[model samples]
Target: MAIRMHAALRRCTWLLALGWLTSLPATAALPEDPFRSPMWEYNLARYLGADAAVRHSDTVVIKTPPFAEDATQVPLTVDLSAFPHEIKEVITWVDLNPVPHLFTLRPEAAEIRTVALNFRIQQASTVRAAVRDEQGGWHVGSVHVEAAGGGCTAPSATASNPDWADSFGQVRGALFSPVGGVTGTRLKVQVMHPMDSGMVGNIPRFNIETLELRQTANQQRLASMALSESASENPLFVFDLEHDAQQSGILLLLRDNGGNLIESRMGI
Candidate 1:
């Protein structure tokens, strides 16, 4: 009986070793454990599939504040301009949030390779950005954000304000000169909406469903993004305007899930 027990233990050890080996990354240079959650394996298997291979990439930059003063409105930026060729789509999420998937952006124009948005973080979480290339390979970027917690379940700030709906869908925008030789116009835009995630209070999910940025002079579409309930109230976006935004200005058009439309322009 003792010999049988010893053999069972050895079999278990070999299975564990096999599991770890199969999980080894396709690229050894890139670490695979960016999620850092105890359920990282489970989450990746569920979200990315067991057969998916993700490569860590410096070209796909994920930026977030080290500490979030307001967890409900934590800022996030994903830039893949460094590898600006044949990007299929970009997916972003907060690993620890109740609603993990924040947004998905598929740029109609290849020149628009960056996205900036605000999202909620339930607690300390690793924010992730994954870009799918033309070949279907995914390049990933991640950042750790520290928060005080309750961002997801907290009451909506817009619901409490009482004046949010009056300006719902109104977009205010501005352009700023390049800072520290960034070589692009800093385009900042804010849209008025509650962006209620439905996790807080009795609020049902009412948020901006889609938004597009266009050059006002030529009406050329620059970038478009889809936002979900994971977005914070009064969603704010700041992005790099490459060429025409400074000269021709830009227009922001957005629509909420409730079928409300908002359009505004800057530098017209």
Candidate 2:
């Protein structure tokens, strides 16, 4: 009698799952077809609450190439110039990655309207940038990036190095005059750390926790961004700096999940 009851429950569960799957539209957003339908409903509802609304905006642009040559270091740029003053925060993530949440940036000033970032894509996924306005509305911009294979579950290249610990928090940065329609002085920064999410084999979760960019002249903070374990190992970033700022340099301060703080300066 117990065996028969268990079998009956299993059959009912299977029927329910089948019904749910069949109820979805043919163009439904699934793991196989992420671009056809935006697969961000779960993430958006979870992070921004179920009542939050997300709409497409021309002002919020996510720029990336159609195909990424390197799945582990695809270059992306987010532009928030249209609603600069109204933007309260920006959150970026990949739709299909094992751990999707990438980072969140809260601009301390209106000058921080654009940012260039490097992150990993597990597969062909929809990368989204959601900007929260001062009035509490979320504006979304997304782009599709294709990769030949996976990135998130792959073993870290830098993590296996014997010398990784010696240079864990080492930072390198430089500033260059804007070219190719990029405004102001472009600040490029690279930090050494394996942003492991623990999804890959025996690796445990380790990532950069916080990043602060400040002007050296007045010690005034320009922006603060928070990163999650979903970020690529050895994260890289670029930001546009106001051309007429008083400083000839900018300071970089970062803290990792292990609570190690490292600071450096980049001359403009």
Write model 2 residue lDDT over 241-265, tens digit each, in one string: 5544734678889998788888998
By summed lDDT, which 10 consecutive residues of candidate 2 come out lowest? Answer: 27-36
TM-score of each: 0.77, 0.78
What lDDT score goes with residue 258 in model 2? 80
Best by TM-score: 2
How big is the positional error of residue 189 in model 1, measured in Å on the Cα after superposition? 0.5
Candidate 1 C-alpha lDDT tens digits along 1-268: 9999999999999999999999987642334585567655555555555766677788989888899999888888887679755777777878888878887776654255567998888899888887878777777787888899888888887788767668767777797776687766667888878888888656788888888877888788877777877798888887764654466777788888889888888775
List clashing residue pairs in candidate 1. none
lDDT of 2: 0.79
